[model samples]
Target: MVKVATFFAMSVGAFAFWQTMDKIHVWIALHQDEKQERMEKEAEIRRMRAELIRENKKRESLA
Candidate 1:
């Protein structure tokens, strides 16, 4: 049927468009990006604390 062919073509085109854009991936990819960012931030906080402790120790030794 012609209608079925048209529908299929439209769906395929929509899917291709979605794949190319940086928006609206149906909440799947967004969640993953947010989770990864959270992990990196936590790691950065830990590294900063370690650096601060080392600096304090150095300052204490010099006093």
Candidate 2:
């Protein structure tokens, strides 16, 4: 009987541990995706700023 109880307890604990780990994994994945998206947005902004500066320089040279 004690052996059966021990087995049951271990199974429950293992299930709980894996469930928590799965949630952690999902959170990490979402965090990474968000970070990637933020980086892409920053790159786009930098590109736009560079283009604007180039346009301004061309205008100044023409003047």
TM-score of each: 0.56, 0.97
Strongest candidate by lDDT: 2
- For model 2, residues 1-63, the per-residue Cα lDDT tens digits are 999999999999999999999999999999999999999999999999999999999999999
- Per-residue error for 24 in candidate 1, Å, reads 10
Q: Against the correct fold, how does model 1 do in TM-score?
A: 0.56
lDDT of 1 at 54: 99
Error of 2 at 42 (Å): 0.2
Candidate 1 segments exceeding 4 Å error: 1-25
For each candidate, the alpha-carbon lDDT, in order, equals 0.92, 1.00
lDDT of 1 by residue, 3-28 (tens): 99999999999998978674656576
